[model samples]
Target: MPKGSGKVLAQNKKAGFDYFIEETIEAGLVLNGTEIKSIRQGKVQLKDSFILIRNGEAWISNMHINTYEQGNIFNHDPLRVRKLLLHKKQINQLRVDVKRDGYTIVPLKMYIKDGYAKLLIGLGKGKKNYDKRADLKKKEANREMARAVKAKNQF
Candidate 1:
């Protein structure tokens, strides 16, 4: 019902750590026959994948969808560049953002929603090393606090 809320198949955990996600948009994938089958089987990987805007169209490169076992001869390429179905206005907006604002388009997650494959893409800016270190420190502090709370509850 909400953005990124679906039967998640794969996620790029590194994206969040490496980039500051400013906005997210759900886009449909133009998959081949066996590609959808493989995705529905949860045999997909979003890691190392990124969204590229070329010729006023959006494409996702390096997204891996494993070949379907049953689709021997009809199997699709595992790492093909798949087209993303976005509206013309959305594509223009993303292109402008990437070209002008120095933002990178990263694929956040892949999921199946209502029998269709969807990709959650975000407009992100790369984080510096200091920012990453700060985030790690904050995460560690949160973990320690949670542990203390749990230990206190056990008493």
Candidate 2:
């Protein structure tokens, strides 16, 4: 399957509006017991999460996985930093892009595939104000055209 093709759990919708995504990579998450339980329940949030490369390893921060209700004492922290499983070659490529080309690694989507939790991360460059405006305008035009075509076909 392609990247981002799975049972989606959460998504960072604002990432598209704020950055221009260049490439996407699928990665596995290192989650604890209760954390995976909560994720399976669809109680996860990736709104403000971001990826950071440190000590040649990739880690995700600010991702929220609500504590499992059934677990009283064995629950994991809701906002703990989770490590990302990636190849050394992939980590080095991402680090180079971030340091040399001003690219940022942003979490795009989280999902479950083959009974494992997967995260889709993107290499993106920050978009300017004018770019955002232009994108909005283009989106509006497309919506209008679609509406017109639909109405015509209904006659």
Candidate 3:
């Protein structure tokens, strides 16, 4: 397999805009059979998901995984809190980082790796409104510069 290649199920694009990501850690999800099926169908949402470390384990809350269409009454809850498997030392470090003001754990991406569901969680600091605006302005400036270069090259 190519390096870093996986079937991505969902990504939280807003996570970057809303927070300054410091570090990312890969964790495994505790998913039911139906949940995995739905994920394979690309029916997962990570926009509102956040990770919390409690009692030495990591838990992800507010992530939505739509029920599998062909699933019967055995379907798992779509909005259930899911456990994330991480090393004890990693969880302890994340807990300490999160204790700092303005810092939180955010779910950045979900994908299937080596036939197993995996989540990429980020340790981030929340961005203020002004920070968001500044980022947008910088993005716009870069876009304009790229456009100018393209036009000049065509001449």
Candidate 4:
């Protein structure tokens, strides 16, 4: 139902590679007219973007939404601290979790749902080098097994 409500624009693939995602949260973003237009045009970047909770409020930084082509002087900054809309209870929960060491909030995806911009953020812990290697080895082994089964079935 959530997927049906919105069209995804961009995703941060690097987030998964660099961190072990522990939990996911859906939050709304506050955007201006031109900023929304720009996002709808697929002119957005999530690389190196992250979320922070400060003073009982949540903010997303380093996320770039390109200026709308048609808007002059009124277009929003490409990278700004955009406020994330979430219930007080949700915010409080996230605030508590984020205070834990080695945990962070990473932007996972940007999408338009019900005519509004939404941010998918994840609570993640940085993965060690060996952990990444182990994941890669597992994926490779799975791929190899799949290929062997497919080849045998085709014979």
Q: What TM-score fits each model?
A: 0.97, 0.97, 0.93, 0.90
Q: Which stretches of candidate 1 lie over 4 Å from their true place?
A: none
| Alpha carbon lDDT of each predicted model | 0.93, 0.95, 0.92, 0.89
- lDDT tens string, model 1, 1-155? 99998899999999999999999999999989999988988999888998899898999999989999999787898999999999999999998889855589999998888888999999999999999999999999999999999999999
2 versus 4: better lDDT goes to = 2
Tell me each candidate's RMSD, in Å, in order: 0.9, 0.9, 1.8, 1.9
Off by over 4 Å in 3: 1-5
User: What is the Cα-based lDDT of residue 127 in candidate 2?
Assistant: 93
TM-score of 2: 0.97
Q: lDDT tens string, model 4, 1-155?
A: 65324788989998998899988888999898899999999999999898988888999999999999999988898898899998998889988888899888998998888788888888999998999899899989999999999999999
Residue pairs in candidate 2 whose N, alpha carbon or C atoms collide under 3 angstroms: none
Candidate that scores best on lDDT: 2
Kindly list the per-residue Cα lDDT of model 2 for residues 42-113, writing each as its tens digit. 999999999999999999999999999999897899999999999999999999999856589999999999
| Model 4 lDDT, full chain set | 0.89
* Winner on TM-score (2 vs 3): 2
